[model samples]
Target: MSTLSTSLFYGGLGILVVGLLLPGWDTATLPRRAVKRRIYWGATLVALPVLFAAGWPDVQSSLAFTAMACVLMGGWAYFRTPNIKVGGRIITADPSHREPDPTPRGGGRP
Candidate 1:
């Protein structure tokens, strides 16, 4: 193996170690969100070594795809969940729910 590939492989392994050693709050309890986070992060870390080992092209494509996916998902989620202020509290407004009047006294001016 070339020196660059060797370094990348080792570097990926190092990242994997760092990821695994990092403390995760509430992960031990196996909550749904925690497990999902771990799975996604773990997969990314593991993919680093494999992509690095595979060569630069694979790494480039993988990174581009990941970045694109993140941006698209972020924008989609941002628009999909619209937040509404109700009685001084911010809450997500569901499609089936109607927002209450913001004016004081059920429609009177504040």
Candidate 2:
């Protein structure tokens, strides 16, 4: 494999494993959201080069790229997708949620 391909493959794999282990790690506490974000970005960063390689016009490069991409994307899609929690009840709404209306009944507010 080319240097880029090897780097992407190994880097992605390393990030994936670290992300998996982060929850159980006792060194420091990482919030669920933060953990998810780290894993997402890490996996994405690792896969970018692989994706680029897979899309290359050259056959050998494409094969290597595809392999790396598959590994990274597969792991990312499987593990990372479900961990992302959005719009949960704990997420506070904007201040506008409690604010009174500023506009007049029919015309623009002064």
Candidate 3:
């Protein structure tokens, strides 16, 4: 029971941390950044006390769970980051419905 709750708390924490550190999150405008800043800080303020209150009775499991969560979430998020190659040319090929004729129409078998 305790392990489950601790694991859930840790998992949520892991997701939040990975989302914070992941690139492209800060690509917002000033107003949008301000709103997100507020929300991020606001969630931290609200969550810490609640988590402390819940985990204070079982410190060991909470810490261990949080550690495992960090490792798992961090690795997952790392691999999921955009793999754009700088200065690389991107070619999008359109699939042809019909194959091209083997020989040209007028110039064939002349």
Q: What is the lDDT of residue 105 in candidate 2?
A: 32
Candidate 1 has an lDDT of 0.45
CA shift of 42, model 1, Å: 4.9
Ranking by lDDT: 2, 1, 3
* Ordered list by TM-score, greatest first: 2, 3, 1
Error of 2 at 104 (Å): 41
> Who is ahead in TM-score, 1 or 3?
3
Q: Candidate 3: list runs displaced more than 4 Å.
A: 11-15, 18-30, 58-110
Give lDDT for model 3: 0.43
Top candidate when judged by TM-score against the true structure:
2
The TM-score, computed over Cα atoms with residue i paired to residue i, of candidate 3 is: 0.34
- Candidate 1 per-residue lDDT, tens place, 1-110, comes to 56776566556555544544454333333433233335446645564545445355566754654454445434432344322334644344355323332333333332
Question: RMSD per prediction, one decimal?
Answer: 12.8, 13.1, 17.0
Question: Evaluated with lDDT, which candidate comes out highest?
Answer: 2
Error of 1 at 52 (Å): 3.6
Model 3: how large is the Cα RMSD against the reference? 17.0
Write candidate 2's Cα lDDT for 1-110 as tens digits.
66765665566556555655554211134444444545665665665565555345566765665576566655654444443334532222333222332233334331
Assess every candidate by TM-score. 0.32, 0.36, 0.34
